[model samples]
Target: MDPEKVFHMTGGVGVTSYARNSSLQKKASDMVRHITTDTIQELFIKTTPKSIGVADLGCSSGPNTLTIIKDIVEAVEGSSHKILHPPPEFRVYLNDLPTNDFNSIFKALPEFYRELRQEKSGGSCIPSIFIGGYAGSFYGRLFPNNCLHFVYSSYSLHWLSRVPPALYDEKGGSINKGHVYISESSPPQVSQAYYKQFQEDFTLFLRSRSEELIVGGRMVLIFLGRRGPDHVDRGNCFFWELLSQSFAELIAKGEVEEEKLDSYDVHFYAPSKNEIEDEVRKEGSFGLDRLEMFQIESNNEDQKDDHAGKIISYGAEVARTVRAIQESMICHHFGEGILDHLFEHYGRLVDEEMGIEKIEPITFVIVLRKL
Candidate 1:
């Protein structure tokens, strides 16, 4: 698989754009701070007198990544201050795919270091950034054993390049199908295959983390997830279904090529909380330190007086980003007009749904630690 081709489909632009958005960054930073203060601090209660190393895996380039790193640094600094001996040096590693926007991340590092220098009050050592080169999946060992004190990953995992071939073809050959995600309501085989892949990938992730983390090292993972008891494919995402329907409508009207629409794929998997916990248990090494699940209320309480205008503006941004992603061919097949039509259709669908007072709810945080 070519890195450029893969990233072009569902990689850089969408993730980078999302990460740069102020609201998302703030939310992620706040969540990281809470996790560090509540769980990580407890784990490091005894591992003093030595410097600590922290890592942010799948850390895409942008202010969002920086925001999370800053929060962790601040928390560590606070923890170190209470100790009798002077605090040890802090090493922070930022790891992402080889095709990731590392240039942006490196460019921002000097500013981060400058800020840390200014913030240091006493004999505190400045935090250092080590750019890590971990190509391919983040589900394997990337660091030395027992080296990391804390590991954090957000909005990254839950993506597998392609569904397992075994699920699609029992003989283990390529099926050349459009996307198994579309077979959501169809056969059990399709869903099972995707689930199996997720299981394998997640298991590898745990095993690798187990080797890298110290006995008491901490990890916090946050991502876009769903809240439901029953497993529904909804095409790997409800949002994707809405966009696809929009595209289908345009194809019917001869506005776009069906071939163009059929050639691409969206790589996202939103697991239920139960499914996630089960995977964690299977890993067997890490113990669940803290897990909190909540529905993020999409409706703005302050916009009660200006509901109509606010909804339109909000829907537009969502549509814009979605369209930008589709237009960029990050998924391989979608063309320029397809994204526009998809966004328009999505906006209309959202408007109709809003009329019924339905607000889409996304899930919240989970934090764990090595036992």
Candidate 2:
């Protein structure tokens, strides 16, 4: 399947929209704000280019999309002050697949600019921040040579450029039978297929960026990852496992065909720290600076005192987050008919699992310096 054509975060302002259900992503993005700030500061301390080029890859449309650019611009402004140099003109690019909802982001830009101007009126030295939307995959070159000083991606890159070919059998059956992603039950070959694809995609990503970024440019990547070298890390595997069970229910009710189960596999993988380091070493264009892992509760929100010893509505919050991430792909592949039922069942399965075992998702924040 073409991820560019099928993949996108849930759009619009509805409850299921990524705009509404992206607090987990917000928290994840905030976690790396310091790293992001320091990297941009280092850029100014080194290059002090007349025009600062920044790109946010996989910048899906939502409140979460422009917020990153805003923070980066703020970082640039603050960093320039410390370096005692006037901040350069900001040339910011927001990138995602061609099918992403750039219009929604464009529609929201007026308010973003207005707020930015209002906030800068006090003492904030506002550089000329020019924002543009670039529609394409980050796995390939998206900017001119040596044009971007810094790059940021959040909650993306776990998606492969495309589904692994090995997942398809000779008869066109998906080798990954009952699961959508890497799981303990997945066949050994299925696991290998995911690892190979991740390595290739990440290598290409680094190669492409190497050409676009100047020497000493920095990139901060935040995404789902495993703690160890295991391909079938259980950190977030249960989420997909329970999601698969939701489809199983539809199959039993005859609302969805069992054959579809054998043909569908999520084009996502959370690589381990070792896997990332190996890929970076092989690519040889960037030096791995810092690799840190953080564990966050399924829901980023604070738990209420009354919710002690209970799941604390984390299941619903998690279901909403997953829905925002996968709704478009699911609708494209499985048809819109099954969405409501599927998500309802998926939420129940998540709640059931929480009652049995609490799952904490692990996020890896990686910083790389251009060589």
Report the lDDT tens digits of candidate 1 across residue range 78-177.
Answer: 7767664455566677887666667766777789878878887575566554544355457677888888888888767666545455543465433323
In terms of lDDT, model 2 sits at: 0.84
Off by over 4 Å in 1: 1-5, 8-16, 25-32, 121-135, 166-184, 233-236, 259-263, 300-312, 320-331, 335-337
Assess the local accuracy of residue 342 in candidate 1 as a C-alpha lDDT between 0 and 100. Answer: 63
User: Which one wins on lDDT?
Assistant: 2
Tell me how candidate 1 scores on lDDT.
0.62
Q: TM-score for all predictions?
A: 0.81, 0.94
| Clash pairs for candidate 2 | none
Tell me the number of clashing residue pairs for each predicted model: 3, 0
Best candidate according to TM-score: 2
Alpha-carbon local distance difference test for all models? 0.62, 0.84
* Cα-based lDDT at residue 82, candidate 1: 66
User: What value does the lDDT take at residue 81 in candidate 1?
Assistant: 72
